[model samples]
Target: MNVSTATVSLALRDSPLVAEQTRERIKDHARAIGYIYNRRAASLRTSRSGIVGVVVHDIMNPFFAEILKAIESELDRSRQTFILSNHYDQLEKQRTFIDTLLQLGADGVIMSPAIGTPPEDIIVAEENGLPAVLIARTVEGAQVPVFRGDDAYGTALATNHLISLGHKRIAMVGGTDQTSTGRDRYHGYLGAMEKAGLPVDPAWRISGPRTKQGGFEAAGQFLALKDKPTAACCWNDLVAIGLMNGISRAGLVPGVDVSVTGYDDLEEAAIATPALTTVWNGQREVGRQAARALLDKLSGASVKPSQELIRPELHVRQSTARPVERS
Candidate 1:
């Protein structure tokens, strides 16, 4: 109480200008007296709400779960509060979340934009002084920094792994042609097939899926084909795992009866019953780097807008093997 108001202010803010012992004493006394710091007042003066908004397609998905955990750890270290939201690939939902963040004066946002998100949507956020960084999917003409794995290269790696294991008739399962990521993965699979000197029937390409349920449903059609594929290169781990379950439900042993490959080497992949073979799409790396970039931007650090593509690695396990000879 003897200290001047200026001293109290500096000590409360933990300003280094205050002596360590003095700052400790002041904080102790404040705690004893039950003095609560007004965060709203501090934010009003600094124009920094210390709130970061994160939006992804689905938080419940293991792929996003890993990414979000990494981002959360990084933000926690910086003492930033993060709000999470899921747009479920809905444009209206994504827009609503962004609007709410803007209203709260959020310092920044890291988003895996919804399908069909236009460049102007991102631009509009920046125009409103809400800086944004992208992850996973990208919007065409959006000049903001985006962090994601190399989708085309990642899928090619998965497809090639299957091919190398003697899977000549490989079917790509569970992904839509609507998003750039989907298109990239499909192209990668197609390119790998062509390069391997393998024939790909147009019927082998099954589009419009990115979830486990979708993959599970696709399994019926996959197994019913007159020329059933010996292996399926799934869009992601969720699809791969689901399809495996479906294969089992259809009275077929997955690893032995049919080979399967998935993108995104999720944590669950190693523990799956058949142990999935997959491409490590660097979900954690994407999250960490995106969070760092957004924090840097908020601190007025010069962060150049560009795309950072993380290289993918293939992890082989028990799921892939030589294609069974069907007489």
Candidate 2:
């Protein structure tokens, strides 16, 4: 017990200032004494908590499950403690989480910002020393590293696929214009429709549904359209699946009487009742790269504030087919 407190402190911190043998001896003795390292105090001293924040729309959503899994894997390798939250597209809830992270001295944040999230919100996080990396969604004018699939292109692929199947009357289900993601996806669908020389009925664009339940409820609305669509290109797999369920309840089978295509090729997409045909939006890649970039920032590396757009691919499944010709 004659060791100087300075030597003990250095040894406890695993500082190279102490000899290897001395450091090991101190650690062993400290362990025997049941001494607990005060990470909070240490964090207060070094301003590093070794904590990261990850907030998504809804973790329960299958669309985000794959992305979160990939992100968890990447952050685990760096031994970072990640705190996850669901904002449910609520701006205040998301800001509250960000504030909590800032107060707790979190090193960085990876977020899929909620709808109506402003660039200033991200800027505030950065100004307060919480660097943010965007995934799945983007805040306009936010100068931060954003890693997400090319949503516009992805939706276009799905729309074009339906067009090829000879569905002139296609309905776009789910999503709203409050977010960049929503606008991009809708524009993608519009682009494809125009390219195919198909008339886009204003009623065909149904917005404000981003979940399975929402999509299920939209089924009746879709069915009530003056010129009912023979095919529906859903915002995501959840909506697509839900709409199919609603359709089935109405005594209609998906992929037969009505063709459907979903975005985000979630695992369940392949195993849905009819096996969904969807666009693979690179969820895993987006998560992995976003996490890696944030970790790099935490390591004192300079990251270019640019968009890393991962291209999407289409997976044809049983959920879609040529629309049946009406007599």
**Top-TM-score structure, candidate number:** 2
Candidate 1, run of 10 with poorest lDDT: 206-215
lDDT of 2 by residue, 193-215 (tens): 99989999999999988889998
Clashes of each: 0, 0
Segments in model 2 whose C-alpha atoms lie over 4 Å from true places: none
Q: After superposition, how far is residue 157 of candidate 2 from its true place, in Å?
A: 0.7
How well does candidate 1 match the true structure, expressed as C-alpha RMSD?
Answer: 1.7
Q: List the residue pairs that clash in candidate 2.
A: none
Against the true structure, candidate 2 has what lDDT? 0.92
User: What are the models' TM-scores?
Assistant: 0.95, 0.96
Instruction: Write model 1 residue lDDT over 22-101, tens digit each, in one string.
Output: 99999999999999888777888878899999999889888898899999999999999999999999999999999999
